[model samples]
Target chain A: MNGGLRHILLALLLLTGLNPAHAAEPIKIGSFLSVTGPASFLGDPELKTLQMVVDEVNARGGVLGRPVQLIHYDTGGNASDALRYVKRLIRRDRVDLIVGGTTTGDTLAVIPEVEREGVPLISLAGAIEIIEPVKKWVFKVAHTDRMAAAKIYEDLNRRGLTRVALITGDGGFDKSGREQLRQLAPEYGIQIVADESYGNRDTDITTQLTKIRASDAQALINFGFGQAPAIVTRNVAQLGIDLPLYQSHGVASQTFIDLAGPAAEGVRLPAAALVVAEQLPDDDPQKPVLLSYKNRYEAQHGPVSTFGGHAYDGIMIALAAVERAGGTDKAKVRDEIEKTQSFVGTSGIFNMTPEDHMGLSLDAFKMVEVREGVWTLVENAD
Target chain B: MLEQLFQFLVTGITVGSLYALVGLGFALIYNASDVVNFAQGEFVMLGAMTAISLVAVGFPLPLAAVAAILITIGVGLALERFAIEPSLGASVVTTIIITIGAAIFLRGVALLIWGKDFHALPAFSGDAPIHLGGATLLPQSLWVMGATVLLVVLVRAFLNKTLLGKALLACSVNRAAAQLVGINVRVMLRLAYGLSAGLGAIAGILIAPITFSSYEAGIMLGLKGFCAAIIGGMGNPMGAVAGGLLLGVLEALGAGLISSGYKDAITFLFVLMVLFFEPTGLFGHKSADRV
Candidate 1:
């Protein structure tokens, strides 16, 4: 072969090896989470986690030898906002990979962009349906509503609680939670006595709780995240109902404890163990991951909240996949993430496989009961 | 069915009480100065935050509430003297723009001063639920309904029995004529703003316990108040009260009977229908002015 042909072949090999996706001056990673609006409670943490991952990676010398630059957009809890911001990040800002959004609806809203552009979107929110209907280049790092419901049912069965009364909010998120819980409750041999709902922003849940109080249900299942759950927690306490109150995964919020005040005690909920991260034993894998993230988070944003911790997990995993892929090749990174096993996540150890994007099982979570305005692990020594 | 109706009533009355309070401010300012203080919701936000902070700082509830009301009054009077007075007799639209600007400005200040998190508040009476005749309610709801009614009644008496209130009414009706009769119309307008803002503060504190107080809380409270006034009839206090209550009930019924997702849509649709069919509103009287 001629010398010129040899040189051309050598340069081509180098181009393929370098992975141009990560070589574009600065490897740009873009994300959209609700930094403002109703879902900010969830978005703020995910944004922080995204910030944490980027900072950590860049500090160690950027992903693929290019300094990692993160592009963040605030979706403001609006689906349109998610769509608009993602479009802006892709079309206007020209980011490499996107890795945010904290609700099923938000991730769903950005699915079109993820499809059209063939860019990987590692969503922090999970409705399960976001990827199930038609998965192109989307993956979730959080448990699905159905999965969470099944876990709750499993927990209830273990406790031998049979009758439940559901009081959820009237919103997309709450409605989804209610449906999933309802479908899964019968499987665990639990009967729902009464189901009631209030607006997402409704502060006063006395009437709803009163109905539940009068019902024959042994326990009340308050669904939905954000202010409504907190209101329910306080209302249940104030109304003086003695029935064991079981909250959906929605109560992982530290804001719930604050809003419920002393009323929060005795309310139990199933959550990924970050809420109990402080109580986890030293040398536990979950402890190191959660503590390191918490310390970094408190330094950057001040204090640690589990609601935000969920977001931190989503971003950390996505960045890891991007690093493994050595570039922003959407399909290659997604494949790498699918093969991720024993990857320590903020919520728990995530082990993704071909069948599941969210690899953590029910055992990965612990039931947390509110005590003294903080979530404590339920005293089930097992 | 009775239980359902009763529950809806409770929700409506609780929410409506807030609207009535805001509507009272609009009615007072409109009747006294022929202008709507668009920043009326800011007064509600200010009152709630001020009282909650004071209560948090170990101030007695009564003292904190009084301080909030007085501070709101001062704010109203100061706003009239400095901001609204300059635009006096300007086009109604111009005045509205000024109020909108003020509302946005006040919201910015609130976010800066109070931060964005919702603060917890204890109900005036501890959270023990009160059951009456097969219906259960929060004691705070009772206080809200009672406070709203009392304030409306007191405002009526003030307009009828007090010299200042009469002068304010006279000024709103005929500014030139009232001034010719040696009434200080500007001071009356200032008093109207003060009373309007003060009532908003009262509503804010009452509702704060029920709904956690936050920076952007008042804007929605104020918009609903505007709707309440429109429903009751502008320039009518009794109409405002009735309108606020009516709107709240409608919203509750819509939420319970229809789709909660479309609850807001139902309320706004009704407002549009009312505006289309009854421009002057049910209780509001028509007023004619020469150009």
Candidate 2:
């Protein structure tokens, strides 16, 4: 009986080895995203974009003549789930690279794992901490919150609106945005006249807005994510606060405009050029890439968001590095990614270096105003 | 400075009216059955979300609002019949636990139906702001306040004047005694649930324009309404309304005049002080219990 089992096992092994001519070894790319939870708005678009680009790449003869495989897990917005999935990606799937981490919390949770496992990670989150104290194997494609702050400050400075009132939500993203805006105010010759914060789940913010209306702020800056910013927009309109209102990139999606309704008109925010892709000047380097992505995505999905733009850049950057390194050698890809320069992407033209992993600058952001319920590029503010 | 205070008051009163409406629902249910209905907020959420969905599907505003309230009442009655009635003889803590479980289940169902996106209802009136003495007010604020006052009076009259209302109050005082007096205790419980659900639905429809609504929207509103009921002596409807207004005004004034960062902290601290000074609540009367 033992001899018969051994002969059968040897015959099975030989049969599997004989079928190797099906295709070249696939390049496995893993991801963990918050695709069905509170952060699903961010992750859903990101997953779609990644899937779309991977299909398009494979259709174009695949990357490095091998089909690209995306092995993804839905984390449901839990940081612990993200860490577990990242470990599984590295140890089980044996993916060459990872291109996800839909939130700052999830990205930060998996940094140590990616570093230890010697797999490169391309995060799609927007936090300064993700790249400031740079991890060796970790990189992000989204603009830092600090860059968003600086871009807003630049617009305010150009418009001669020096005194700013700040209304913030007490969530992690909003708190970080408020801090960046506050810390960068002095550099742009701006003064924060009033500072008010509300709870993340607080239904009413009229009290805070009343105080802001009572202040002598020349411009108002509201930093928050999710539904709070839309509520703030409505309250600002209701309170009749006439100052120029500025929001962070946190509320850059089309959903914000829909939720805020007409009150969203005239509100300005620093956002990726992907938002106003159709309106971008023809000479703009990002217009072609943005339009192509916007068209491709909107054809499959109903609407295109900047979050999806981040993922598109992430996979493209990863593939570019793989090409430059001649293989998915982790260390070589890391070196090539660090040496990247002038790579035009949906978010911006990236110029990576050892010192600056998130290579996009403030110019990657465009100060766009809501005009008649649509994004109008604010040329003078730039 | 005075204008700022007035603005804060306007904002506070608008916000308070919502809390009062929700608190009144809590008071109504607690009075009818000694069990606090933790799913009260889900009623509010279901009302607004259903109304919004109805309007999206071609129903007129008034029709949608009425239909949404009826649907919410049905849900409340169903909850009582299916979940609470089966466990009628359970301890108060167990009943409360059941209601909490029901609340979570309702929230999960809402998530499945409406997803996690925040949805808004158009204002009943125009979205124009009325400027008065260097402050501004949305027309919807007036609607909220006016409707709240009317509902408070109506609810008070219902409890004091109607025979059915008296039956509900009789249930609150002593369930065994109420059952002995030829009252259908189960029917009274069902009535309490339905009435409170209607009240919660109205509150949701009124505030949807101002606050927006989501599957999880009821969590904070419910907590604040519970605080209102607790601060105003848990079983007293009028007291709960008063407690809600007081909480709203204090929160607004504190955030406006003091530190905005400490707004929630200040409100909870005040609630704690009230509880410390009077264990029976500020408006609660001393009662002797016989074993």
Candidate 3:
């Protein structure tokens, strides 16, 4: 470092240390999110929720008697960019902990960096692989695709739809969801009679649907995100397929309904309580939490997606860990995060453990159906 | 058995019509200026996004579609003037690279204007499916197919029968000779861009309901359309339309009968086979015709 800059940094540190009213330095929380790219739908709200939560925390006299500083960078959904920014967050910004990575690719790309640096990272991405086999110093708030698959299977079992056909998109999220569904099918007493896939950018999936139609499957599950799920919804209707259609939580937002138009009617999916916050019972523990997050987010950002709710749970979990740790010690904070238990947040009641970094279970997801162009809770998880 | 094949055929034809429109656009610009406008896909995206925006602002669907097509045509003309025309006398490879740059710029502009959200345009007709002997077809699919037939006929007539169209063709035949015959080569090139843009917009508007429209939607459609042009013969408009239909049918059958995983691979393998057997494309004429 230059002598002049080093001296200036030392002087600023001394000034903060000398201040009587606020002796403790601000705790630095770093983040890198896909705020402006194709996955912005996930990262934009994530960034917003992080900023809003940090602001609210600061307004409430900060965490542990010190101001919280959020140092964030927009990775634009690129994995390499996410890694570079994360390294900078650790080496340059010297943040105490991190609480972002909008997509699974971004999260996985920075996993090795955060692990080596011993910084606590609570990712917002949904892939189970992020936390599977338990990487120390890493936790994620979003319910993995495995949870989504189990929740859907639970719903299917309730309805006695034993034979299920799978149509998946050839994308990461869909491919993972497809794998989880296939692996968990036997456990759920469901048979995978037909399994087909389509390209992400395919315009027509009728041929695949037709093949599925010929199968004796009693239900259809589409594993995909983006507009492909919407297209599948439409094609199912056009082909006169009478089987029940279930979509993955990857498309739990109203944008899916808007894109699918009337075809979204009667489609079921496993989603967070945030999507149907108003419909939750008054006695439900997550009701107040979901409603507050929904109202606060919608008040400023127009709508609330489950993606943003994941961020809410993530930052809240991080701050709660920091408070429990009593200081910005990375090791202590990591342990505190792993010991998180029954913390009611928007996505679910997270109960992190040393073995399971992602604390959400099948109960975290509520089965929802599209009724009259709005999300209606089908079954509330107890 | 046969029912499955019939269903695949119906679906293939409906999707093929869209590829034909976009492939026809590629063929038009290629024939006019010998520069493969990679921005052709952006034209499709612009058309769909513009129409959706127009409808959102309370324009009727038909009127919005017309305005969208006109707006996309304007974008095409602007692209030709600002990006393509400026690099006059550049190598073919240079001009092609310029179009790729144009495509990226157009996509960026679209991302800024439309954001990253996928916007849906309501179907031109009701989405009620018509049962064709156990096979089902959407009303929008009919609109797409009928519109494709009408457009292909219109474009063919304009190119083969009209004076201005013939002048455009003459430029493709021999730019220097056409210039000597008092043909305004620049005007012909501009017309090709305008016409190609209009075709792309119509394709976008027609398929937006089925596929939905987003800033990135054009990338795949454009690539498929380019493949259609290649399979048909780059310079052959009729060949492009046929190539598009053939590719779509092959893809559908490949997915349905063989494996969905190899759908694209199978289609590309066929394309490669054709390219290997017939380097001039399925319908491309020999060099004697150009001379």
Candidate 4:
């Protein structure tokens, strides 16, 4: 060979030799959460769990022997901010996968962007719309409002509570829950006698409660989160209503019990098994994963909530997909995520399919009631 | 039907008392400084948050409440001194804008101090509901009404009977004339802020048990209170009480009878009607522009 040809061949060999080992890029995961705004209660814990899991995965050599990079932006519970950050993550960060959204409103805001970008997104929001008419690139880990409503109605049915009163807040979650209850109550053989709604900032719901009390309702089902539910609890007590109160999974945090105080006692809600992890039977499939997550999380943070478990499941599912796909190729990863089945996660045993983005079923929730400010498993209710 | 009416009435009165209390705060600040201190609602939030924190730290409820009111008074004085006093000779719009800025600043400060969690104070008495015919009323409702009435009486007496109160009114009527008469207009303004803040704090503490208090609670309460102030003639204290109660009752009735979803809409609609028809308000004097 000529001298020039020999030198070019040598340089090409050197470049090819270095490329195999060093060319694997880190998998970028972006998240837009309401870490500082009204929905911080949900976002803060979720971000913590994501960070902890990412650190643990990286410590274990990450997926496919490549490091995972997490890019998190605080959406501040605002839909516009969520859309802005989602665009930024896709355009600027070039993230391979995304996981976030504390509220349904924010999650819905970013759906079009995530779909158009073809980046696989696992939303942490509980709205069913995040998954319904399932988009190719979108999935959710949080139990949907429909699932929660079904669980609540099932419990009500078991108790033979045929007549129910619904008091929902005027937020997105509450509105969706109200719609689900209205649509699904007939299926569960329950009649909603009085459906009332109060403003999210309303101080007193006595008038609503009074109307409910006078109705033919045998029980009160309050579908809301935040201080409004607590205020409703207080109002129910103040109105001397003697009916049973069923809350949605929205108020699954200890903060709800704290805000409601003595009034929170005997209030039952459908929550993920992570809430009563220690009380789970030894044979329960989710117990070990739930307990481990609970311990790891509480060792650093104060308490572990199911909201955080949603993030854990989202991250774990994404990691598992990357591992199964053997690379961070966006299409391959998205297909693997869709094929996820029987993956034990902090939220539940995820079984993602092409038709079902949220792999969780109604069985993922256990009926839990507050006893002396602590979540206790309702006996034989699940 | 009677029972429903009674329940709505009870709710209206309770909420009206709170609106009145907040409206009075607005009026007090408007009278002295000719600037509507939009931060009036923050005083309420501070009162409830401070009181809750104190109570959490094991102070008696009464003592915590007193300390909360005192701290809010200090905050009001500081706001007047730092924010209002510096812009004394500014245009009325400028002063009003400054007050709005002050409100935003106070809310941000509160968010940092208390975080974003909602807090509740135990009712001053207990949680028992008093059975009145077919309607049940919380004991705290009575406490709220009683406190509002007592404050109204005390303020009426103060404004009518005391020299300091007269100086405040004199400042409100004519700042230059009051200054000419040797009244310290600055002191009167400071006192107005202090009293207004204290009044707002009292409203916060009284309503916190019922409403629950969060860092952002001030915005809605302040807006509604401002509406009450406008409804009752902006500069009239007694008019504020009447306007507040009227607005509250109307809101409760609307919610109880009409769709609850349209509760706020109905309330604001009434305010719009009032503003369109009676530009000055129900109790406002029919006079030309003072300036």
Best by TM-score: 3
Candidate 2 is graded, for docking, as medium
Q: Model 4: C-alpha RMSD to truth?
A: 4.7
* Model 2 agreement with the true structure over A1-382: per-residue lDDT tens digits: 2565445534534555644354356878999998877788799899999999999999997766668999999999899999999999999899999999999999999998888888989999989889879889999999988998999888887887899999999877888888998899899999999999998787779889988887889999999888889988988998888888899888887878888999999999999999898898899989999999999999998788899999999999999998776557789888998888999999999999988998998899999999989888998853
- Chain A (alone) TM-scores for all candidate structures: 0.90, 0.92, 0.92, 0.93
Greater lDDT among 1 and 3 belongs to 3
lDDT of 1 by residue, A165-251 (tens): 988887677889899888887678989998888777665666566667667898888878766787787777766778878787765
Candidate 3 stretches with Cα past 4 Å from truth are A1-25, A36-38, A55-61, A64-66, A380-382
Per-residue lDDT of model 4, residues A298-372, tens digit only: 999877888899999999999988877766668989999999999888777888888999888878888999998
Q: What digit string (tens of lDDT, one per residue) describes model 3 on residues B229-254?
A: 98998878888899999999999999
lDDT of 2 at A273: 94
| lDDT tens digits by residue: candidate 1, B72-161 | 888878888888899877877788788888888888888777766677667898877787655566788888889888988998888878
Better of 1 and 2 by TM-score: 2
> Which lDDT value does model 1 have at A299?
86
Candidate 2: residue pairs that collide = none
DockQ scores of the candidates: 0.34, 0.67, 0.82, 0.64
| TM-score of chain B for predicted candidate 4 | 0.96
Runs in model 2 lying further than 4 Å from the true structure: A1-26, A36-38, A51-69, A73-81, A323-327, A339-341, B285-291
The predicted structure with the larger lDDT, 2 or 3, is: 3
Instruction: Score candidate 4 by DockQ.
Output: 0.64
| Candidate 1 residue spans exceeding 4 A from truth | A1-13, A16-24, A238-240, A329-331, A379-382, B1-12, B57-60, B74-83, B175-186, B247-278, B288-291
Which prediction has more favorable TM-score, 2 or 3? 3
| True-structure RMSD, every candidate | 4.7, 5.5, 4.4, 4.7
lDDT by residue for model 2 (B1-291), tens? 898899889878878877888888998998888788999999999999999999999999999999999999999999999999999978989999999999999999998888667888999998888887877788888888888789888888888899988888888788999899899999999999999999889989988988889998888888889888888888778888888898999989999889999999999999999999987677865544311
Interface root-mean-square deviation, each candidate: 2.9, 1.5, 1.0, 1.3
